[model samples]
Target: MPSPFILSGCSGGGKSSVLDELKDRGFTVVPEAGRRVVADALQTNSNALPWIDPLAFCRACCDLHMQDLAKLPNQERRVFLDRSLIDLFAYLEMKRISVPADLGAALRAVSYAKTVFLTPPWQQIFVNDQERKASFKEAALEYEHLLSSYRSLGYQVTLLPKTSVADRTDMLLNELDQMDA
Candidate 1:
């Protein structure tokens, strides 16, 4: 399986936009699991929400992420993932929820690209939606947690510039090109 290149950071930090841009540029991409999980819960009126039951919510997100990872085709091309399994741990930390041992083990087992692209808190582009309810302050805190989590896992975290989507995509593609070189 191709090792995924992860774009992870605070919600509303334009990670999704970057993923979209990458997709447009013909790269395989994985959508954020948490957004899909939350949207499904809301649609089904389930209690698996972050604010309602963070553990359950995180578990669902992780399951989705694992499923997505399992479906990735084995190839040489790099797949761009909006987030990875480690994001669950970061979310649990930010929410002050206990991280399950199984979750930790899973995080240790799963692998991605050695370098992760991290989008810092961009207040100008940050906004709340149905799936993203975290305030800018909360988002910033989450960004810090993600930074720590990814670094602790020994992945090199490259901070994406707080710039336009096109500029960010150009920067990311350029970095990937250098990696290929």
Candidate 2:
């Protein structure tokens, strides 16, 4: 299986923008699961929302992420993921929710690349949408949790520079090229 390259950080931290840039550059990209879950919940008028039913929301996200991971082509050397299973753990931590044992097991079974691209909290670009309702302060706290989660999992967290999407894409491509060399 090809290990995924995860782009993780707080909400509205330009992860989606960076993912878009990678996709435009011809790389396979996996969209974030949380947004999809929220959209589905909203459409169905279900209580599977982060604020309303966080546990259910998280479970749905995990299921979707697993499906996405299963669909990835094994022959692909590198794929960019907007977020990974580890992010769920961070969310649980941030919400003071207990980590489900099964979820923990699932997270332990999967593996990602050692170097993860992390975008720090950037106030200039941070914005709350209907789906992403976390306050800027909450986003910052989430960023910190994400950093700790990745580190605890023993992955090298590479902080993406706070720059334009084009520049970030260039930086990522350069880093990948160097690693390939």
Candidate 3:
């Protein structure tokens, strides 16, 4: 399968908002795995939550992300992934946890566009939701980790300008159009 374009950054930095806008415009987008794992855990009253069992939570995200990728059409579909398996790997590294063997193999099995659109941390737009409980400070730290990790993995980081969602969406589309050319 062809690689996807990923939107990733700090947890609450509006990656989802941009993806929402793209979806509104009828573009194909993959949901973030972390949020889905958290929501599922909460619904099932499972202890695989980040606060309770972080390693398990990370593994769950990896599994879900892989599943999400599996559902993609095996072609250059121009799919935009909201975060990715690498983001789960970044989270593991940030927490100083060792990556499981299956996780490494899974990472090797897939690829994404070399350029990743990263939303910078903006305290003004950050909010504390039930799924995302990280404080702004913590989220900023996570952003640093994601930036470092993506660079280490040879992905070019494109920081999304801090602006209204509409502007961000337009900028992203322009980039995608260039990539298409």
Candidate 4:
């Protein structure tokens, strides 16, 4: 079976960039579904979801992740996940949004990569692009929340080095290579 590798962290943590690099190296990369969904909703209708409800948005996000997980091909050597379902909890906690009982339980069952790669907050490389909706400080809190959630679930999380994007990509690839050896 092909092991899925999840790249998760705060906004502007270079998760997407690293995923692109891995994709270029012949790895199957699943882009962040939340971003894609939001962009599409915005483009399709000006006020498609103007009044954002955290619970509603999170439900959609979870569904998107489940879809991605189901579509994975076992023959692929590696699958790179841009974000995992656990992200929804981070968003909920950050926004102080109440998590419904169903959503909370469902999220716990959503399995991500065994070795989740986390990118620490790197201010030098963190730029607020159009797609990046969270500020540096907000992202910091969200990152912490994410770490806590994963730890609480007993998932072993690995922190990616705070270095050049290329170097980080190489480091993860090397780690995966060792695992495959």
lDDT of each: 0.90, 0.91, 0.88, 0.77
Judging by lDDT against the true structure, name the best candidate. Answer: 2
Candidates in order, TM-scores: namely 0.96, 0.96, 0.95, 0.87
Q: What digit string (tens of lDDT, one per residue) describes model 2 on residues 1-181?
A: 6688999997889999999988887889999999999999999998889999988998999999999998998766579999998999999998999999988888978888999999999999999888998899999999999999999989989899999999998998889889889
For candidate 3, lDDT tens digit of each residue in 48-117? 7988998889889888888988898776557799998888777888788898998899899988889899
For residues 9-54, write the lDDT of model 1, one tens digit per residue.
Answer: 9788999999998998888899999999999999999888998999
Angstrom error at residue 68, model 1: 0.2
Which pairs clash in model 2? none
User: Model 4 misses residue 39 by how many Å?
Assistant: 0.4
Which wins on lDDT, candidate 3 or candidate 4? Answer: 3
Poorest stretch of ten by lDDT in candidate 4:
45-54
Better of 1 and 2 by lDDT: 2
Candidate 4: stretches off by over 4 Å: 46-51
Sort order, TM-score high to low: 2, 1, 3, 4
Model 2 scores worst on lDDT over the 10 consecutive residues at 69-78
Clashing pairs in 3: none
> After superposition on all CA atoms, how large is the RMSD of candidate 4?
2.3
Give Cα distance to truth, residue 73, candidate 2, Å: 2.0
